[model samples]
Target chain A: EPEVTQTPSHQVTQMGQEVILRCVPISNHLYFYWYRQILGQKVEFLVSFYNNEISEKSEIFDDQFSVERPDGSNFTLKIRSTKLEDSAMYFCASSVKGAITEAFFGQGTRLTVV
Target chain B: AQTVTQSQPEMSVQEAETVTLSCTYDTSESNYYLFWYKQPPSRQMILVIRQEAYKQQNATENRFSVNFQKAAKSFSLKISDSQLGDTAMYFCAFMKVMNYGGSQGNLIFGKGTKLSVKP
Candidate 1:
């Protein structure tokens, strides 16, 4: 079965530095999302993307966070100046439709900011 | 705001035994979707089963089934004839059926329940 694929299974970055997490959603999927889970915490929604633009974002997705679908296949999340609290597992998901359809999730990218 | 709660933090069942994982959610919307996802040590989130609120009948897939009590706000997963491969962290999630521009597709996930199937 086709699945969402994320790059760089794990990443380590210095505080105040930038990091980019990439995802390639299923080819036919029309909706994409980004969610994060702090160690020992519930997964939290970050943002949703459709039509190459942001659809909705949470408080955690502040100015420092940005998402882009630079190409037909690549979706990326960029964090400018990472904070220690930013350490968590970031997941990318996609679906053929919106909330009504089941969203498939990727293995997740573990982001560690020291 | 919506919240999903998985009361059982950890549960273990012997191979070939049946196990049920409990999940309760708080939602005001009558039309919504409930999902159960399994995440193994690989950390890959895999969809186990899904139930739509409007459906009165329970949803089942092979050995996996769900008892969705919309009135009680309870959606529990039941694994029958469980095997060692069933060991994993299961998450209960909620999604509201709305067309609020682009925000309609977000999912609210619970803390998850860790299940251990001992052979």
Candidate 2:
């Protein structure tokens, strides 16, 4: 089975520094999403991308956070200025259609902001 | 807005016993989807089961099954003959359908219930 893949398993950056998390969604998937889990907290939705554009985003997704499908396979989440609270596990997921369809998730990238 | 809630913070079961994780949601949309995802120690999200709101019959997959109540907005997961390998954090989520055919919808997840199966 095809699985989502994320690069830089772990990222440690200082506050105010820019960080970009990359992921390769399932080859045939058309919908992509980004979610974050703060240490010992509930998973929070950030944004969803489809047809090469953002379809929906949660309040947590702000100007500092942006997503891009720069290439067919590469989907990225860029944080313009990281904050201490940004330290968490960032997961990238892809689904063929939407919720009705199973969404496959990557191992996740642990981003640590100091 | 949609919100999913998993009341149990933790649950345990004997290796050969069964376990049930509870999940409930608040949504006005008649058409939506409910899902159960498991995150192990590795923190990888694994799809455990799913049920459509319109389906009155519960969905079952191997040892996993779901009791979806569209009227009550309740979706609970049942894992029978549980094993140590079933230890993980289980999350309940809700998603509503959008414009496109199965267009991606935002997910609202519960705090999650941690399950530990002992041998």
The alpha-carbon deviation from the true structure for residue A111 of candidate 2, after best TM-score superposition, in angstroms, is 0.9
RMSD of each: 1.5, 1.2
Clashing pairs in 2: none
User: Relative to the unseen true structure, what is the C-alpha lDDT of residue A100 in candidate 2, on a scale of 0 to 100?
Assistant: 65
Docking class of 1: medium
The CAPRI-style docking tier of model 2 reads: medium
DockQ (Cα-based) for each candidate = 0.67, 0.78
Worst ten in a row by lDDT for model 2 chain B: B97-106
Superposed Cα deviation of residue A42, candidate 1 (Å): 1.1
Q: What is the lDDT of residue B15 in candidate 1?
A: 98
